[model samples]
Target: MKLHQLEALVASADAGSIRGAARSLGLSQAAVTRALRELEANERLPLLIRAPEGITFTEHGKVLLTHARIVLNQLEHAHNDLERLRGRVEGSLTVGVTPWITLTFLAEAVRLFRERMPDIRLELVEGLMAVAQPLLRDGSMDFAVGQLQPGASELEFASEAVLTYESSVMVREGHRKVRARSIRELLDEDWVLNFAPDGKRDLVDYLFTRHGAQIDERRIVRAQSVATLQTMVEQADMCTWSPTILSHVPPFGGRLRSLALREAFEPRQLGIVTRRNSTLSRAAVAFIDCLLQVIRRHARSAKKEDLALFKTLELLI
Candidate 1:
């Protein structure tokens, strides 16, 4: 099947409707439908189940959709690389970011990168670190910045550190629990924990688990993003762990009163990661340099902000 057919297939899977897929690719609905047919014929599998509301992928269709997306992303990047070979530093670069970084530092990096390379197509995919690693391996992403959990081998080190920062219990200002100086005093208070699919929640969980404190899982106000968790904490008697770096922001710092988590509630490491044993394009290398420069400048200017981090040498080093 043609690349356009695969592109159309992937788009259809993404948008869940022929009309929506057409809009995304700037193609007519009939054209997208025809392309999907062509892909289905080539694969000899029904790729979609049409419904009134939207389409759903059949079992085989889901497999094909996954393969189709990987192929289309690579083909698009290949086309971009061809353009770059002619001295145009232009191509799509998709990066995976964790929710925590997505809320804070990513905005600054995106702002600076766009100014320098406006033509470089950018895609930011945000999810848990576990979900992002395979995309990095399959060439769907050029780089990623997130926390590294145990046994994540696909992600090679670009530049990262044990980025140390104090943990704070985020609560509304003037809340009674805010008066607690230590986590011990606040133990009986309600907690809004960021629920992990498996494993511990945060640095607080790590410390408490190590010290044999039972994490009251029932007290958790499970949330996927910091904003949502913060919102719940603001409205209710629950509190969440807010990294000190985030507390620097005015609205977060002002509206949310932070009580110390205890001495053991040290900082978690935030690493800049890429696929292991993978080669980066020239443009990708340049973009990584730009990202590092941004980080270095931020580190230098905000030395007080830099709590305790292990700065490994550059990836090129």
Candidate 2:
């Protein structure tokens, strides 16, 4: 119905009670109750159930609440967009980024953005695509930068390929399997996984299965952080898979070496992801421009051989 009515529904759903919603909305409890009652009357449906414990949504209420949240969120984005158009530096932006992207072009892009809009608040979340999609869908995050596998879902998202990298099998400097060239050669050694659940099939699992073989699950070790994964690979007889680019970064390069395994995922590249058909805020457009700028600059300054295969991703003028 009305915007205030939608606000009351969303706030009540989030806070779980009219009193709590009133406090959050900075309105009186009577005001919140009235808004909720009016919203129910307008829709001719009961949206909430009040109990001793808390508030619960009915079936129709649940469906309507989802739309209500989006409306309010889009309204806020609209306000922020207009503020930017008026040359006002107000409102915050949230972006999801994966590890390597954060460590690479993000630093430079953020520098450029901060110089242009110093007062805008920024939130950078780190995780894989699985963790980012829900936030992206709900408008919590404006966009994300991460690896984009082929055949990824396209109905709700769009991708612009930014950088492509070769893949590598990494091991410690003097590890016994450093010379191993085939997938079968390294299946027996201990392995470490260094990413959160990405919902899709993982590199190691896919690698083995592609060759009609499998890695013993018992030999697989889970390491959540880069430091842990590197430490294990460096000090112990273990190995891991990574994008070939990581092997060139300073500290990581010194800790491990890429095995000469002839394996790589097709489209071993990174891209910018956003919700399809959504209008991005002005700040988001500016930040993404910087992202593309950084990628272009990198393609120019980087060694010729290193980016030789990335011709498709790096569209320089």
Candidate 3:
């Protein structure tokens, strides 16, 4: 279908109605309706059903909307690239950031990025790689920054590790298990850890299996985001497995502490994830540079063993 037609469809779906789409696109509602009708005629299928509540996509419409968004997003990237190449600092950028990044150095990076490219529109999505994968694949996000786990290569994404550090078991300031030194000591404790679809990758399994003990699945809580995990740890009698650097930052530094267990877990590699074949726009590159700058600056003053991971930062970008 034509670009305008696809834009009309995507805009309608995004805005939830033809009127809203017309307003966003600065066109008349009748023109938007005609464009949608023409798009349906070109495809020989009904795309949207208009109702009082708004619009709903048909099966065919749903399928087209996926590709439509990717196409539109790629076109925007191309436009941004050309503008930057011509010495114009203007465009949009969407970067997915995990909780650790969002709570730590992201604010400084954004400030730096804004100073360098004030005209660019910056959008930050706080989520894990699991949440970011589809968005990155569909071109809704340019890249993601977080802890890269094993098997990430199988997802057809490229990653660049900036910091290498171990994950830690965290507890609230006055937690009963605060003095416990090993995984075995945590069996009876109420734990809040991340979820993995497979049993082998699950943190509960890892903690117990390593100690040759049975998992206390009944007392465990599975959380999707580190933010949620930290909240539970701080406000309740729950301990969570988190990045080592998580407890070293502000607010959390006062609210929580790393368990300092005698046992070791897999090293958490913090990095940037992007679609395998995707070319980052100029804005993406500039934003990442600012992030690295912040990391380097922070490393100079970081005192904790975990926070010092930035000193060993390796850039594969």
Candidate 4:
């Protein structure tokens, strides 16, 4: 089928109707319908069913739409590559990052990247791996920076471990439970936790199980935003497990303190994740370099206590 026909099909699927697709593509509704009909005629199968409400794809249409998206994504990538070959990094770059990384080094990396490639558009999405993975697989994101979980190597993505960092149980400063010596002793207090499919939730549960304590789901408030977690810890008698870097940053740095739990878990590996076998744009490569540089510089000038803590946790830099 013609490229225009594929474009019509994909755009209509995205917009939910031929008229909406025409508006998006700056074409007439009749033209969009004609292109879609031509595609169906060529395939000798009904692609979509038009209705007053909108349009619904047939089973065969659903399969074709998936391939159409991949083709369109590849075409866009080719255009970006051509621009890069002309010695200009002037295309859009979408990146996904975990909250801790966003707070620690992502802002600085973005600033430096903008300075070097001012014409390039940058989109930053902050969330957990469960949210970012789908975007990466669907060609909606260029790359991601976050924690690498167990069994990551089995996935269809390439991951490069940059550093390993420790996590701690944090509580409001001067809270009565700050001096609690054991995990079981702090179980009475409510907990604010990051809500991930199998990431932070699993870690919290593992901590309780390892300490021979049953997890009290009723006392847990699951959240994904760092700001919400901080507000809850500051205003309520609640605690959370956070990256050591977060405990060293503002609002949290002075307002929160880590509990001295008797049991210590292994440090988590932080890194970059990208779709395997995909060609990256020059802007994406440059941004990844910028991130690594910032992390290395921060590691070098880190405070002695911070270095000692990383060493104590057996973290790799």
Candidate 5:
């Protein structure tokens, strides 16, 4: 079938109606219906069902749609590969990052990269390391920045030391625990827990659990979002464990005070992770190098105040 026909079917499945799909594809309703019929004929199976409410994809249609997307992506990659062969770095790069890192070094890295290489497209997906790992393996993400974990032998990954930092109790400006530098004083308070499979979550949970002062898992508010967690900590008395890196920047360092946790939560390793075997485009490689340079610069300029901010993120270079 034609690419347009494939796109039509996929769009129809996504939109759930010919009219909606037509709008999405910038085609007339009759044109969309014609394309759907052509695709159905080419596949030798019905692709959509028309009902009172709207249209729905048939089982065969769903499978075809999945393959269609893969095929389209391959075509785009082919085009990009040709562009690369011409020694032109002009395609998009998508990087997955955790929220705290997004608020910290990523902004600087993006700014420097854009200034240096204006032609390379950029995209960012911010989330937990657990969620980002699979995408890295699937080749969806070009690279990521997360904790250096134990299982590097299995994946194509390269890591660099970013920073080292300890855990601290974080609360809104006026929260009572903000004044208490001891874990005991903060234990009873509800915590906005950061619990994921990565080192940050693991180390924080390990310390609290071992100390017999684990935040009430039942009362715990599991906020995977950095912005949400920050907002929750700011609006309510709920406390969160943070890396000292956050204290490096203003508003972040100045707005929230991280009282030292009494328990010895070991310093977590923070770093940049990139696929080892993957052939990075020149643009992507350049961006990564620029990011490493930025990390080095930040490290040399690391002031006591910055470490306080870096502590919030465990940022090291």
Candidate 6:
């Protein structure tokens, strides 16, 4: 079938109606209908079942739609590759980043990248790995910077470690309880937890279980935004465990204090994750290089007090 035919099918599937696809593709309703009919005729199968509500794909159409998306993505990549071959770093780069990275080096990297290649457009997708992984696999995201779990090695992606940091239990400055000393000591404290439904919750559960502490579900407040979490901690008697890097930054730097805990938690790995067997654009590579440079510089310029804190956490460069 023609590429336009495949495009029509994919667009229709995404839009859930032929008229919607027509509007999106800048084609008339009759043109979209004709294209769909031609595609089905060529394949000798009914691809879509029309209904009053919308359109639904047949079993065969569902399988074809999957491959159609991949094929369309490959075609787009081919165009990008050709542009790169011409030594043009003027294209779009989409990157997924966790909040920690965004708050740290991402802004600086974006600024540097813009100065180097002003023609290239950069799009940043902020979310956890669970939301970003699918986008990466489907060729929607070029690369991602986030926490890489141990199980990530089993996935069909390649990752390179950028930084390692320990998680710290934090509270507002000058709390009544000076320090926890141990996880068990903080069992009765109100906690502000990450809203992301992932290993973070599991990690907290594991720590509480290992320390023989019962987690009071009623005392737990789930929040995803860093600003919201900071507000909760500053205004209430709530505690949270966050990446140590945040403790050195503003808002948390003076307003919040990391509790001295005798028990150690495992250090988390931050890294760049990219799809395996996919070619990265020159722009994406340049952006990552800029990010690494910023990170290295930040590490080098860290104050003695921050260095001491990093050493205490056993963070490896």
lDDT of each: 0.67, 0.77, 0.80, 0.80, 0.70, 0.78
Give the number of the best model, judged by TM-score: 4
Off by over 4 Å in 2: 33-66, 148-152, 194-205, 221-228, 231-237, 302-317
Candidate 6 lDDT (Cα, 0 to 1): 0.78
Tens digits of lDDT, candidate 5, 233-299: 8787787777655544545666777676556666776666665555565666777778777766666
Sort by lDDT, top down from the best? 3, 4, 6, 2, 5, 1
Clashes of 4: 0
Question: Between prediction 1 and prediction 4, which has the larger lDDT?
Answer: 4
Off by over 4 Å in 4: 1-6, 34-50, 56-70, 149-154, 198-201, 302-317
Q: Model 4, residue 277: what's the lDDT?
A: 78
Clashing pairs in 6: none
| Residues forming the 10-long window of minimal summed lDDT in candidate 6 | 308-317
Instruction: Give per-residue CA lDDT, model 2, range 214-283, as digits (tens).
Output: 8787777877666777788888768887766666665675667877766645536577888888777888
What's the lDDT for candidate 3? 0.80
Per-residue accuracy of model 4 over 85-191 as CA lDDT, tens digit each: 89866678889998877766788898889897898888999987777777777678888887645566337678778777788888998888889878898788899
Worst 10 residues of 2 by lDDT: 308-317
> For model 3, how does the per-residue alpha-carbon lDDT over 1-317 read when each residue is reduced to its tens digit?
79999999989988999999999999999999999999999889999998999999999999899789888988999988888889887899999998877867899999999999999998999887767877877779999997545575447788888876567788898888889888778878788877545533456556777667676587888788776787788887797877766666666766887887777776667788887777888889999999999877777665665345453344343
Higher-scoring candidate on TM-score, 2 or 4: 4
On lDDT, the candidate that comes out on top is 3
Assess the local accuracy of residue 108 in candidate 3 as a C-alpha lDDT between 0 and 100.
96
Itemize residue pairs with steric clashes in candidate 3.
none
lDDT of 6 by residue, 108-213 (tens): 8999989987887778998767667777776678889876444653376787777677778888888766566877788788888674465655666656766677
- Candidate 4 has its poorest 10 consecutive residues by lDDT at 308-317
